[model samples]
Target: MARAKTTYVCQACGAVTPRWQGRCESCGEWNTIVEEIVDSGVGAGPKSAVAGGRPVALVPLAGETETAARVTSGIKELDRVTGGGFVMGSALLVGGDPGIGKSTLLLQAAAALAEGGRRVVYVSGEEAVAQVRLRAQRLGLGDRDVLLASETNVEIILATLQNGPAPDLVIIDSIQTLWTDRVDSAPGTVTQVRTSAQALTRFAKKSGAAVVLVGHVTKDGQIAGPRVVEHMVDAVLYFEGDASHTFRILRGVKNRYGATDEIGVFEMSTLGLREVDNPSALFLDQRDRDAAGSAVFAGMEGTRPVLCEIQALVAPSPLGTPRRAVVGWETSRLSMVLAVLETRCGVRIGANDIYLNVAGGLKINEPAADLAVAAALISSLTGSPLPADAVYFGEISLAGGVRPVVHAPLRLREAGKLGFKSAVTGRLASSDQGGDLAITEYSELAALIGQIAAGGKKQAAE
Candidate 1:
């Protein structure tokens, strides 16, 4: 028997140190270092020569003879986000906050595939088979002949998939909860999470099974456990939404099969998770009629055109610091917009507590929302709101000039579909041909503010 050496690893950055430290020097996070034993007794020989496993050299996939076929994951919204569907033998990691529907989404997808006449197996590490059955019944999935198992051991999972009947799709309730006997650490630790993920990645490739791994997120929103877990997977999808809100978004952070920026929206209901086809309409629901401090923004998330509301409130701050708060939009980004208003537009809101929010619990990070933010601030400051059926999409510079945004035509077309009367954008001449909707363009923020204060009133009357 040989003794194993131990090394202290930073849980935050995965930097290994000889000894424990109070803080991780690489990531600057405090008290995140943990000691792990490095076992050196195992032989560094190829196990691929064994009867069960075979190895192949890596080569360019373009040289391979594999034909690209679109395999639906069974969830329509998820398929849209993933660029039609999951590729054959592709592995996906779905991560989200607790109670954010990560498990439910994958389970629903598995049921859908089973119903589509494809064999699907769901291995639950956290819940029992009965619990999974109960949830499946609620989702109206009884007609499908899906296999379910409640186990966390990686060997059992692999053996079941290998020797038993072939399944088209395989789903693990969570990757963090699964553990391998080879690793001496507990489940969800760096060693256990990384090792099991690597094994599953290999299994998915060899068995030609589309694997979906449910992942847990840390407090700061990164996938929990080892960083290597994300690297090992093929695609990383993040399920993001406020638990208080019914709408949840499945965004592809990384995708080997398709575009990474796609997003799928869903609404949680009593029957399970239901996909929202017309997300723009759902986002604009219950919008106030010609209300102050409100403006619509035509923003593009990935290739999808979304009409989101930008709500701003400019009120006197009771606090001495004049607080600045924003929901669904970055606070730092909002601060820059406020400074642009003060310097370029000459609409000072320094003493007032400015607050901005994106309606329908959807967060907007695109620069196209800049014009809408500016217009909302001005509408609140001057007490002259834009028309209820108006929307803005353009980026504002520090010097108050309007910058052109990407996909202006798509934004305008979607706005037209939503019955927006006006499309305020940087490309004024280009939008003149758009029938039925007024195209207003302003080079300077001050001029735009002036137009929005007066012209908005006229548009409302029309």
Candidate 2:
């Protein structure tokens, strides 16, 4: 008989170590290493009673194949974020902070799918059946012909799924709460999470059911578990929103069959999460047009163009090291923009407390918002209010030159659709016209700075 094997694994980063240590060298998380027995019964192991597999034929990359049909859940925003709809036999991992409405969104989608005559199974590991039913009733989806289960044992769940009619969609409330008899470690451990995910992914592929696994997020807003879980799934999405705000954003970071970096906006209400058909207007609603530090940014998320306000405040600081408080944007990007303004534009802006925010709680990731951020900062520094109808987008180089961004025509088209009359962007190709709006092209950041300062002077004079 082969001797049992034991190993130490880091719960935070899934790094395997021979011995336990104070902190994980990979993720720098403390006291996360745990010991577990390997080569267990359920999974594979060395010198075990399991048999070897046979080789299969390989196919060429270029081959004639039919595209798989997608199962629509009837929730437009959910379907949009999942690349038109959930593809059959694809596994997805969705992560979010607690109370951020991850369950509500998935529940809504499952109900929609069930109502559309698709067999849907919702297995809740975190909540009981009564709690889920209460929430479904609260969301007014109680009448939907959806099946629910409150279980966490992976074996039992798989057996249950296999015994019933093959479901079109299977939503697991959370992957962290799942445990398997194959892994001797506790639930939510690195081994268990990985094994459970692999089993479910295999199930999805074999049974042609779209598996949606919900995951909890850590304090740093990353999916709490081994990173391998993310790799096991075909797609990874994040549900993000602020508690104070009534809106939520479902963003896709990885997709094998669809575009990445896509977003779907939803508004939370007593009824449930409602899709925002026009996210540009939803993000820019109730704007303070006369605010000196506010500028609208025309940016893109995947294939969609989004317009949001960038607000800035620069005030004299009493402390030697002024505070740089930023929300909904990156601090390093802010620092880079500040350095460019001071070094290239000869602006003395570092000796103040700077605060920046993207209005309506929207987070921007693209570098195209550099021009908008700089404009907001300059506007606040000079007390100039950018035109409410004007939109800004472009990249700023360290040499203070404005670089053109992709999809300029699309951005301008979105601005025009929202009743914006003017656009300030980088040099546009001649073929790409302003399309019903006054367009201003800038090759250098200094030119826009001069224009904004001149506007401030002109406003002060008036």
**Cα deviation of 68 in candidate 1 (Å)?**
2.5
Query: How many pairs of residues collide in each model?
Result: 0, 0
Q: Best TM-score goes to which candidate?
A: 2
After the best TM-score superposition of candidate 1, give how far the Cα of residue 45 lies from its true spot, in angstroms: 13
**Model 1 poorest ten-residue lDDT run:** 39-48
Model 2: weakest 10-residue lDDT segment is 41-50
Local lDDT at 63 for model 1? 62
Q: Per-model C-alpha lDDT, please?
A: 0.82, 0.93
Give Cα distance to truth, residue 224, candidate 2, Å: 0.8
In candidate 2, stretches whose alpha carbon ends up further than 4 angstroms from where it belongs are 1-3, 41-45, 48-53
Q: Model 2: number of clashes?
A: 0
